[model samples]
Target: MSALALLDYASVFVFALTGALVASRAQLDIVGFVFIACITAVGGGTVRDVILDRPVFWVANPNFIIVASVAAFVVFFTAHLLESRYRTILWIDALALAVAVPAGVAAAVAMESVWPIILIMGVATGCFGGLMRDVVCNEVPLVLKQGELYVTCAFAGAGAAVVLLTLGQPLPLALIGCAAVTLALRVGSMAFGWRLPVYKSRPPRV
Candidate 1:
């Protein structure tokens, strides 16, 4: 398979794992776990394709569905055994976000989109799956929450990709830069518990 195809498959696997983990936490059945996993794996790409007016990539290539299904099954069966190791799962999730952000940016750039549009598409392709997954799992979406540098990291990576592309960098180098920066930011956030400050409201009068 091509590098891009491999990237997509990796993204699908990790996102499917994330969804399955969430479902397991929610005490979902096997079928529900798989359903959530499949949606999380493909949600971002589907949104990107719809917005771009392109044929959804997974619809054109059945391998994506096959891989996602297999991954969902694997995670669904194993999630309980893995629950105590949530740290590992979080690491995998971070890696997925790192890889997916640049992959999405590369896809947009491959289509020759303008920089602004590329950035927007990149963020959509990066975050939509996680957003859907969280909503389905009844959690506040990470990006929408006050804490964590989730979508900010995505935006940073996507913006970096666009800038590098505009500067005439090779695609491989640009993508690497984007992915590396994203991973660093995410890992740092996890290690440092980095979060946007919460707003405080004034006390109500008695």
Candidate 2:
């Protein structure tokens, strides 16, 4: 497999693990866990593909499904061993976001689209699956809440990729730069408790 394809596969597996972790915490059954994992692994790619009018990548490759299923099953059976390592979960999530964001950007760039669409696709690939997973688990989506610099980091990385590509940088180098920036921003946000201000509505008049 190509380096980009390998990175995409790794990201999918990591995201699948994150989904299984959430489902297990929510006390979901095995089927539900697998369902969530599938969503988390492929949801972003599905959205991206639909928007780009391309065939969904996972549909064309059954290995993605197999990997997601196996990840869910492993996490389901071994959740207790992982329960106390929430930080590790967050780090893995950051890694997945880093890798997937660049992958999405590369896909759009390969299609010869402009920078704006590429950045949007990158952010969608990085954040949308987690957003859907959180909503399904009855929690505030992390990117929508005042927790950390989640989507912001994704955007920054994606934008970097676009800029580098526009500047005639090599594709692999551009992807690496984007992923590194994403990982740094995400990990820093978590480590330093960097959060955007919460939006507060005014009280109703009497």
Candidate 3:
């Protein structure tokens, strides 16, 4: 399989796990688990492909859907074995974000997209799936979490890829740079409390 296909599979499986975990938290049934998992697996890629006017990934290959459903089914039966589903899902979600960003970068670059569009596609691929998952599950989207570095990390990673390409770096190195930056920033945000400043409300003057 191609690297892009591998990347998509990794993104789908991990994101599906996180989605099913959220479904478990929501106390939903098997159908719900599969629903959320499939959505989370393909949501961002679907949007990216649609915007780029390319064939949607899952539509072209239904194996992606099968993989996502399998993940959800497995998680449904075994999620309780994990000590802390919340923590598990958070880290898995981070991994999914990292993997998905590079996949997006590769697609946009292959299509000869400009640097800005590349960046947007990267962020969209990394974020939109989880955003949809959270919204459907009635949880706050991680990308919109207060002062969180989620979306920022994706953009920075995509920017890194653009920079590497502009510097004449090879495509492989550029993708590695994208994944490394995205994972590093996301891990730092979660492990080291890194954050952007949030607007604080001020009292009205008398």
Cα error of candidate 3 at position 83, Å: 2.0
Better of 1 and 3 by TM-score: 3
How would you encode candidate 3's per-residue C-alpha lDDT over 1-206 as one tens digit per residue? 87778889999999999999999999999999999999999999999999999999999999999999999999999999999998898899999999999999988987899999999999999999999999999998888877679999999999999999999999889989999999999999999989888777688644
Q: State TM-scores per candidate.
A: 0.90, 0.91, 0.95
Instruction: Give lDDT tens digits, candidate 1, residues 1-206.
Output: 75566677888888888888877778888788878888888898889888888788799897887787787788777765764745765787788888788768867876788888889877888899988998988877766756678888889888888788889998888888888888888888888987666666688744
In what order do the candidates fall by TM-score, top score first? 3, 2, 1
Residue 55 of model 2 has an lDDT of 81
- lDDT (0 to 1) per candidate: 0.81, 0.84, 0.93
Pairs that collide in candidate 3 are none
**Model 2 per-residue lDDT at 77:** 90
lDDT ranking, high to low: 3, 2, 1
Off by over 4 Å in 3: 204-206
Quick one: best TM-score, which candidate?
3
